[model samples]
Target chain A: MNSAALPGFDDILAAAARIAPHAHATPVLRSRSIDAIAGCSLHFKAEPLQRAGAFKFRGACNAVWSLDAATAARGVVTHSSGNHGGALALAARTRSIPCHVVVPENAVAAKIAAIEAYGATVHRCAPTIAAREAACARVQVETGAELVHPYADPRVIAGQGTATLELLNVAGPLDAVVVPVGGGGLASGTAIAAHALAAECQVWGAEPSGAADTFESLRRGEHVTDFVPDTICDGLRGTLGAPGFALLRAHAVKVLTVDDADTVTAMRLLWQRMKLLVEPSSAIALAMVLGHRQRFAGKRVGVILSGGNVDLDALPW
Target chain B: MNSAALPGFDDILAAAARIAPHAHATPVLRSRSIDAIAGCSLHFKAEPLQRAGAFKFRGACNAVWSLDAATAARGVVTHSSGNHGGALALAARTRSIPCHVVVPENAVAAKIAAIEAYGATVHRCAPTIAAREAACARVQVETGAELVHPYADPRVIAGQGTATLELLNVAGPLDAVVVPVGGGGLASGTAIAAHALAAECQVWGAEPSGAADTFESLRRGEHVTDFVPDTICDGLRGTLGAPGFALLRAHAVKVLTVDDADTVTAMRLLWQRMKLLVEPSSAIALAMVLGHRQRFAGKRVGVILSGGNVDLDALPW
Candidate 1:
């Protein structure tokens, strides 16, 4: 996808229009207690409560809805071990289309159940990225389904940008927006939206210190991969896709890394102080702000709580 | 605590007006997925997000605010192991009054810290119901602090009623309202409000099976106590207070009980399905609705998620 020629804010608005009836305009929450602790006024955009239990629903719904009747009739397929599979499954269910998800056998049982519950066919593969990709390709070849890459697709990015559009509309102006980077779908969308709406507003991506592929990639001015991460943030384990990396480079997003312990502490603090139930992946942005307080001290910060689909019985802490 | 001449709905409305500026009118959430699973439309009045982190704050704020200037100048005292202590402490801090909490030594470290963080002094006693009361009495005698009983006080009940008033206003008429029962402040207030607004609406009290003293008392037509509860729902261990029992008896409220395992399951399900971080005590109401599905099938049921103050690391599951 070309950054200069890619769809802009108008595309985001159109995506919002297309998916408005299917998605929830999740509320933006302000926390005085959190503000006092952070020494900053913090606005939390609660995308955890979005349909299919994450912000991925925004992009998935848009991607599925943007398909013409003929293409939608051909069905859709995606490879994911995170929120995107469940989101796309639910979105395809809404459109009465057959959805196939290629998931690793080691995927979280609850998430896999959620995907199946949304009426999608699940194709299990070995617990390797290569095996998952091969399974998805096989499914596409066998069924002639249109592939929707979670973050690499253009429509998905536009859909994800609508979250920031709504956030800015509700929270007014902020000095900075902090987003957790997994494959950078949410971060790229937020950066693009922030640039379009408030150019001066800084966009920062928070990644797990263990999975600092994006951080290293941005610093080295090239895509990084082949390094294994041992982070508790299950959702932020993927390397950035090419489109996401290009968008991040074009936007010059600042990248910060937080360790597993900081993510756990941040998750606990959110539960204790903010009364929010967020996955460790969502805690990455919060961990960045709290663990590296000097960079954000006394500044108005907007943090996207990306998702809350955590297994309470098996919390990482 | 006269049951024969209980204050009218107008008095409750007055309490709402007095506390509206200080209290949060927490958002009401509707879950289509929960509706599908339960075979009923469910409306959740999220008081867990209330000021000071529980519906208890509504009453505590009202109780502290309703005090005469002379009485407030003297100071205030209450005995609680849960949300009420922190709420009253914060409420008293607002008025620059000395607030003393008589807490059991075994009270969770987090709750104790919250009470102290709000600038209230805590007097620790042995971990028993009798010891807690004795400590409160001793403090009142020594400091002349006005005793603010956690649930038996009429002012406290009136303040808690505001939550139901706001719920009804936002969600409109519902066929039934389900609230958790401990000392019954929230349940009693909810019953009175539902009775006043829509006489046809049924109000039910959800109690843990291990702590079903309220169920026994209602059946026997008198208050019952002395039963030791072994439930994981620590917040629902209290025997029903005098005013709370009288109001519940007079209102003809139904009592439903759920086991501890059900409560934990409900807690996890709420986190997974509803994206709400609630304690085991709060999950009891959802447990009742889910465990006793036949009673709620095809009806509009409103549930009060009482609070979200939980030790996530040691969640009772």
Candidate 2:
């Protein structure tokens, strides 16, 4: 696959079939109180309940499985200090393949423990992109492992699209689908699935205001990745991937930015009202829906809760 | 129905049909990590996802719907300060009937708000059982409403059993089923359903060590409700009802007592590992199983996560 090529809807379908045995067909949950507050019928695609407690599992599982047997036998390597690393590690375990994760030295011990718990080798480096990438490269060479880019890879993008495909298939006809934008894999893939399967269904991306590189890039009609993230959404601080940017732009996906305060409030509401313990990154989707009630009023909106991995001791509220 | 009479398996089946439209057939969730920890195949009946965020909704809905049109029209009244109050209120709203909740003066403000949010009339009284009963009686007399006792009512017991019924129907055959013993509605109902459907499956009750009235009652072969509850499980502080005791004793249900610390540990594990934010009251079931792993080893155990109604600001751990 070309480095900058975006995965198509057909690729998403293939990814869905490939990961059917591994990934969970997470339930779509509804909250009446949240609907009343937002003035819209919201169908929540509960990816928080996915394997590894995030939608990242879909993409990681697909990437791990898409490799040829020879390459798969050599194992897979990724650099992530968040859900994708654990997701990839778990995906590798499903196939009984060796996995290596390049983690930042400053990464939370709990997150590193979680990745290790999934039976992955954790290689820690200094807390910088250069250090992380070099660590990942070293691991690939050392173990003859295949390098699986977390979001930029086409296989991962197609896997991410599977969640939206399932959502559309189960949620009937939705007026719109909103997904949180981090490295843009989920948002772009969601756009592809929603456009191909339900053309009339508008696709929107929710990003944290403090880490709105994707939002800025779309606004400027170019790539923008110089901003420092100050948001509480740890999983959403990455710059938008090149392929993800291309797909999202081509699909004309709308981007909505929400403040961290609003995301925290939405997170609390999800916990208190919907009984869902989602992280700030996942809650940003709900924040977008609630903040833009006028635009979504009386419409059926599907919001993907991206993940539920949170440090319970350090809750935002 | 006699006040001390136990509900039969037939009543549970009828209740299942009666409340099918109102109550959710909650999903049975499984966690590989949790299963590995206990050395048992655990099927967690996710009642925390049930309507009103607890299995209480099942029984409450059944009770409201079981009433005759004229009696239901007069409405239903209950004295509760927790999930049952909110559940009854929501259940009554389903029937568009007037519901009165006699909440104690010291009830959590959030609990009161939850009940009021469901359109139930809140009547505050002193924090004594006598005062709560008096307030319920006043409401019953003033509005000619039917009194819906929290647990003692046969209709409610039958309704609570529907959760286990659905669990048994979907989870195949289980070696045992563990339920938290609160006012005993869930435990007694579970025993009735488990014995009738899977006669070989053992039924066990988990209770807070500080509120082990049910445990003591079973040990002494009589009712025991003199001790005050000191545990953090607010929902399990209630004394076991007469009907619940009679049913539990007749079914030979065994009770297991767990410390509050163990319940908190299990609660955190559920939230962190399984991504399920269950209350300590519900976590007690997992605590019971983990505490007695040898008894359940190599067996399929169904654990009911009773509810997810917790004060986020006041998590034990």
Candidate 3:
């Protein structure tokens, strides 16, 4: 499979099989109280309970295992100080492969500690995109390890799609599926899987209004990267990836933007009512569902709870 | 069949069969990261994710459904401002029967709202125990509803035991099972189930140091009820009921008491590491396991996460 090409249903299918032994088949949960509030039957794909505490494990596990023996022996590298970094490191450990993470110097201490805890070597660069990329490139050149771009890589996107594939299979049929859009990897993968398996299932992206690049890009018919994100959702701050954008565009996926305040409210609701400790990024999907009741009223909706990694001391509420 | 008698393994089996259709058979989850910290393989029976957000649902469901057609039609009543009231209300809703809760006026509005949301009529009384009991008795007389004691009744204890019964079935064999001793319903039931199913399996009760009634009772060879509770584990503050004390004493169950500080820390760890939003009461079991590593080291320990109903605004940490 080409690394730069957009991932399709076949790629997702292959990725699912590849990561089956490594990634968790997370449960699809429901909350009647939450369902009543949204006026829709909700099937929440609980990836918060996934290995490494997020759905990122699916893609990371896929990418790590998809490598050839010689390539895998060389190890894998990525530039992330969040769930993806932790996930990739944990995935590499399963295969006894070395993992390198080029993290920003200003990354959260806890997140960096988590990456290190997973037995990954963390190389800190200046807290700038260019410096981070240069450090990653340097690591790749020096270690001869394959670079796994968090969401931009075809394999990663395909891996992320497996979550939706499992969700669709477990949830039966759904009128629509709502997934939180970060760099659009999950959204893109979800679109591919839903389109192939449930043609009638409409795919929707829930984006934080503070970082609505995907929504803006779709509205303008092009990728946008000019805005700075100021939302409480730390994971959804990344600009839209090109492969993810292309796939989402091809599938005509709708984007729903939600306020961070509303995301916090939804997050609290999830915690208080459903007993789920989902992050703001994940809760944003539910926020979108509740915010737009008319679009999903009385319908069976599948919601992808993207992750559960949160700073206990720095809660938005 | 005798409400006053201590429930046996047979009663638990009956409860398991009775509540199978109404209650959730919650998953037994494992966290490798958490296991590494505790130096033991921990199988967490997640009752926090149970219907009505606690193991109380099992007992409540069993009691509500155990009623004959005429008795059930008359409705069921309980006096609680916590999980049991909500669980009983929800259980009654499943049978489409009227339910009444006698709650103190000083009870948390959120909890009262939850019980009401489950379609139970809330009967408010003064904050004193006598007043609450009087009010509950009045409701029993007025509505002709059967009284379902929170943890003392045989049917309730039998119902609570079903969680451990399911845990053993899913988790296979375990060296021991740790359960929080609130009113002792869950603890009593757990002891019966574990002793009957796996006679070699030891049963340990985790109680808050501030509310160490069960520990004191066991130490003194009699029930204790003189201490003023001061723990963050609100659910474990109740005086151990006579039936529960007798059952625990007969089973020779050991009780481990944990400080509120340690319980808060454990709760935070559960939320952060496992993505499980367990209350301090639920987390006490893990606290006991971690605190007494020597006892549980290298052993397979089953920890019942008693409940997940928590006040987000009033997080102990």
Candidate 4:
């Protein structure tokens, strides 16, 4: 993909402005105990407190609102079993457009209910990425709706970047910005915004060892599509999207993988020390810093707590 | 106890100034999902996100700062097994003075560790009010340190009131303000602040049914002093402090009691919907309001989430 096809800082700025009226500028929380444990000053961007209880709302809102009149009139469709579906449903609601989501048959019941609660039509797929995509494509063809591919879309990438943009603007001069990578929308956007706003700042992406496609992709210098994710971080189970993968490679964003146990430990620590209710996916960013203290020690690190949409009855701990 | 001895709105203003450089002016968090379920506009004053993970820091800071230079030079002493001890310990550290906390032997190890982590000298006593007080008095006499009673001191009362003062000032006029009544310090402070700030606003106190002294005290028109607390809300086990009770009575604060089950449910909902890690004691405030929605229905109610210090292994659920 050409650089022109990828999102830039201007797109991020526009996304920030476009979603301001809808999305929350979630707080930047600090914890002395957490900092002491990590041996670094960490500023946590709490996207768990965002509009749809996740930062996915940023990208979803940007995609839904960026649509031209006729395209928007036909509504939007996507395939997600997590925050993205709920976020897109909520975003489409703002524009009074219909949203169709292709979720897996084995998806968490609570998540499906949440997506439906946000007014999205749910189509159960056969618990495979290929099945989900096929179902989504069928919905798009039948309804003449636009497919808002979660992370791969330029608008969605720009929207995700706004979180890091807000964090850098408020926290000021962070030595590094770290984001949890799943499909890589957030990490790609974070890299673009961090580079554009804070030239000296380095961006790193943390992925689950159970779902280390992004880590493998970066190491092999190409997208790695084969992996059966077995992590506690449900949100970080997807394969890295091509556009996001390309953008991350181009920006030289380093990728690291943390074990599920470490992510759970990080989640508990965040809950205990920071008084934040974040999911394993959100906690992985902090886990990355703690696991590799030599790289982040004594530095000001900005961590994006991606989301907080866990089932309370089935907590990993 | 006389009205003149109680903290006034002016004292709250003074406390705010005294602790401005130390305490966090905690954010007012709102959730449409919570509001929809409760049938009210529930604005949460998130003190769980405050220093020492509770609102106790406000009172502790105010008391520490209000001391004369010579008195402050001698440090401070208190008897508490929970957030108060940790709060006072942190507060004393800010003033560069020693702090001695008399915690009971039966206190949770996590709570004790947290208090000690705040740099306080911990003296363990038998799990009895008399034993705890004796140890506190001993510490004060031996070290020439001032005793800052958790909820009874005028300065502490004024300091705790500042949470509600800031909330009223920022969240605008509320129809009612509800706070968890652990020993009645926060309730007393909240009542005084609400009455002074919004004369028409009703102030309500929530207590665990197992530790329902405050509810019974308000009902009997006297401070009830005997009962072994059996609730999961460890922070509310203390008998209602005399000064706090007198202030609550003077301000005509209504008191309500909630079962441990309801408190746990409220805590889970707050964690799930609001993305906050609050203790069961803090959740009781919202439980009281939700249990009696007829009173708060369609009204703007300010609910104070008092603290967030819980053992992950021993969650009520």
Candidate 5:
């Protein structure tokens, strides 16, 4: 074990308490059709219906709520392509504080509209990670707003863990829990909670094969900074942040990757069969279970459907 | 008041017992965002997630299950464009009996696929309602399968009523319940259930203005015929069946109409804000509530989302 002094189940519980008022305890759905296809009993924790359209809301709300009175008065700033910006904007609005979101110029119009709808000021940047970070920093300095990193903050990770807490509370004694890894906030939170509640339950992380940096990092016992991701699961494109990686590494979560084609197939299956309109990012986790069937057969498994912020016009068939 | 006897709450309770193993007790959803938009607290009774992808499953399941052993041995048949065919097919499959569905030649490929997937044989006919009924009669004559009218049968109406029974059991008392009207099975069933359990709670039916035959019939105090519908809500294009209309007449349910464009807009809004993937037919009820906002303002309302059997490739914008 690496034995890194990272936040544990206690921290996750505290985060849950902090975020209880702001976050929705999203439903856990079970489908016999899905279970029969996967050859396992599956519990789907639906966070797509969560506030601001994703589990990002849990973390964003927690991060925004944790700020001191003076710091909150100064406002909060972050950078995101879609869900996170909307989440932070809504969270800040709830606190009567200003929110400044640095968004990519090419971000979806609907997502940008949602951010603005929640009373956030948007600063458009070039469609690059570097440009987003630079724009966020500039806005923080110019507006005297405290920077709230999307996935790097400890409070955000704790808030994200609250979802798994609710899932386990409803699902009860699953053999494994799978979560999609974008920047690893959800994965880390889920791993910590699952480990605390049921030590025997294996905690696994699903990532897009097109964006398998977390998988590579877990395999190498260190962070991997080498690849550019080009997956349809746009939400999982970013590399895992340091705090998230540390918690995941300490918890020893197994990482599996699903290809983009399988992700689209999963999305269609969910919509057509399950009547759920989840996004490509959420489908990635289902794709992992389906593609890697031999490893999960006959097990009681739980999977987090991270969000449903899909643009119907741009759905990849 | 014409007191021509119709099935009541007791009949719906019997239907629930008969279809308990066959039909899903669908989920109920509450959303703060929807409440904010509609200026009322809203509870969505989600029948869209029912077996065979609609609330038709309840009626179909009850109709099939209510058949005598000799009649069941002969099997069953129905005529439908989509949902009822699939629902009957699945319900018959549960009894290990053959099912024949008379479908229009122009029926959508996805619906045809669903019918076939449920182990039913499809008999193709011309696109007209007369042609569909003629084809169904021919299939019954040839196969000796008993005709199970989709919405006209008393057993089917009784089964559909179970949805409201379950809704009231779960969501408690509400000021009103709104349901979509096609052949009037769901609306009549819901009205009967509400009258029996919560007499003070008003029951209303929503119809697309493009296919407002039911609305016109209610206004004229008689059945209307010889009207063609050109609405995008394919599932709600059916004219009111005799038994269904009789039940509605006995119950005196109010009917409201909304335009097709507003139905599409409501579908988009539900998808974007509530993360619910409902069909256009289902959205019509929501459109009525939104378009006639004064009728439901500050009230506790329940809306039945009848189905989610939509073609993702051809979603009407």
Candidate 6:
């Protein structure tokens, strides 16, 4: 749990073994149209088709299963009402343990319904980050549930890394592996995985111009905590976690930022060309490549499509 | 191309071999949430991920390849402004032959752009069916190009059947194979493939209630062609072809119709739950299963998501 000694590929391997039976080995998709547009051969690791419609399930599964039977019996709690909460809820269901989600009062009904559908109790809190954290703390005190901070947890990062591990194993050596950065769980894990598996492969992080904290942090040589996020990518509005930042800093991962407009265009292109319903955050990875075609031209690049939980009524286009 | 001399299992086998070198073996997707909602174990053969974003490529590839070298050297032509025209154009390109497409003047610019993007020369004609046919005939005469009908041709039907062949071959065994019916190209081909590969498997056709000619014709034991199609499923607006009808009748393929509203709802649900961007026609197949749960409940059902060509600017929902 210490940033000084982060989890390595060994922890990722252990997470893969722990979550193998519960998690899906999602398909790797390729599109000639996309290849032509981006001027690169793209291997899309489709985590949108994962158990909870996101890669968060792998980490949630590992974190839930890592607990001993006695500790897991008390259940787990998280301050997320997004993909992580739903994933955690489903992971808890698999272990037959109680799960509590602290959701902001303004969270979408459909998302809350999805989390509740996984049989997790929902606790409503004010929309502020502090309020959500306080509510999560209250749940932890009341139910004696273990808190699984969405990205800061080392087990969650290790679980997320397995996606890149599987991608490298299946797609073989690649020019680079691109991932969308939010709290940096997936990006840090992927950097570690690519380093451990394919040393020759470069690791890059994509961020929305609106929520470019990760890019600015890597640029300024330290984490920048203060920022007002403004991005349509709901799953990627959180600040980068300390543990995830340490890993990214240690690995010297290059972070690229794309405008929200380009992210929307990329998302539309993905839906049209690849027939994949990926979120705006996931599209940023491809946007980064398309915007930087000179760098990735004629190379086989692996991109992780993080999630697919979208509100149909409130479409961006 | 003749109704009396319809294609059978042998033709499908030949088609599989012919298209193997050109077409993609698209992945079959599974979703736990969809299964829970539909009360069936569904194996979705995702043809949207196929080349040209539809199963049309399989038949187009088969038709182009079925022609001898001398005949293919001349070229290929078709009257279509949808997935079929694009598929034939790409197929012709693969064989290094000129492709001519006769499109109605009122066809969407996006559809025409996609067809032209594949290097097909577009010949504009009036929106009337007779004008389109006359234009297509002119192209055939002038360019000495073979006329490949969208779904009526025997070679095309056999080509379409290969999608089901691959699905059955990969998904192992299924209780039934469901497909969307327009001109019955995919439906009849799937019926034939199911008969050949899995005799115990029942084959059903899904159609839009607004365009229920296939259902009416099968119910009345004849081909019916005097009705206007009125559905959001643009891919399924055409009448059932004579040869396709004959094959369906011979195989006794049952046709079920779902309302356009239901098809749209199903399409939205697929995007939300399965992370798939499927057209309304493709969604009808799953709508049928969900609408008639008694028939598909507790069974392993195979449904072909026929295409992913959607107008992002004008979504039905």
Assess each prediction's global lDDT (C-alpha) against the native: 0.88, 0.92, 0.92, 0.91, 0.87, 0.91
Q: What is the DockQ of candidate 3?
A: 0.76
The residue pairs in collision within model 4 are none
Worst 10 residues of 1 chain B by lDDT: B1-10
TM-score (chain A only) for the predictions, listed in order = 0.96, 0.98, 0.99, 0.97, 0.96, 0.98
For residues A1-317, what per-residue lDDT tens digits would candidate 1 score against the true structure?
23234556787888899999999998898888888878887889998889988999999999899888998998999999889999999999989999999999988888898899999999999999889889999989999898988887878888999999999999999899999998888888899899999999999999999899999999999899768987888889888988789999999899999988988988888877778788899988888898777888899889999998887657665
Query: How good is the docking of model 2, as DockQ?
Result: 0.66
Poorest lDDT segment (10 consecutive residues) of candidate 4 chain A: A1-10
DockQ of each: 0.74, 0.66, 0.76, 0.81, 0.60, 0.88
**Is 4 or 5 the stronger prediction by DockQ?**
4
lDDT computed for candidate 1:
0.88
Global CA lDDT computed for model 5: 0.87
True contacts kept of each: 0.78, 0.58, 0.81, 0.86, 0.58, 1.00
Q: Can you tell me which runs of candidate 3 are displaced by over 4 Å? A: none
Q: Quote the positional error of residue B1 for candidate 5 in Å.
A: 22
Model 3's CAPRI class? Answer: medium
Q: Per-residue lDDT of A40-139 in model 6, one digit per residue for the tens? A: 8999999998998899999999999999888899999998968999999999999999999999999999889989999999999999999999999899
Tell me the TM-score of chain B in each candidate. 0.96, 0.98, 0.99, 0.97, 0.97, 0.98
Which residues of candidate 2, in runs, are more than 4 Å off?
A: B2-4
lDDT of 5 by residue, B5-103 (tens): 466778789899999987888988887777888998889998878988899999899888888899898899999887999999999999999999999
Q: What is the lDDT of residue B106 in candidate 1?
A: 85
Q: DockQ: which candidate is best?
A: 6
Candidate 4 ranges beyond 4 A from true positions: A1-4, B1-4
For each candidate, what TM-score against the reference?
0.97, 0.97, 0.98, 0.97, 0.92, 0.97
Model 3 clashes, total count: 0
lDDT of 6: 0.91
What residue pairs are clashing in model 6?
none
Per-residue C-alpha lDDT of model 5 across residues A1-317, encoded as one tens digit per residue: 01123557887887788888878898898887788889988999999878888999988888788788998999999999878899999999989999999999999998899899899999999998899989988888888898877787777787788989999999999999989998888898899899999999898888988899999998888888778998999899988888877888888899988889998988888887788779999988898899888889999899999999988778665
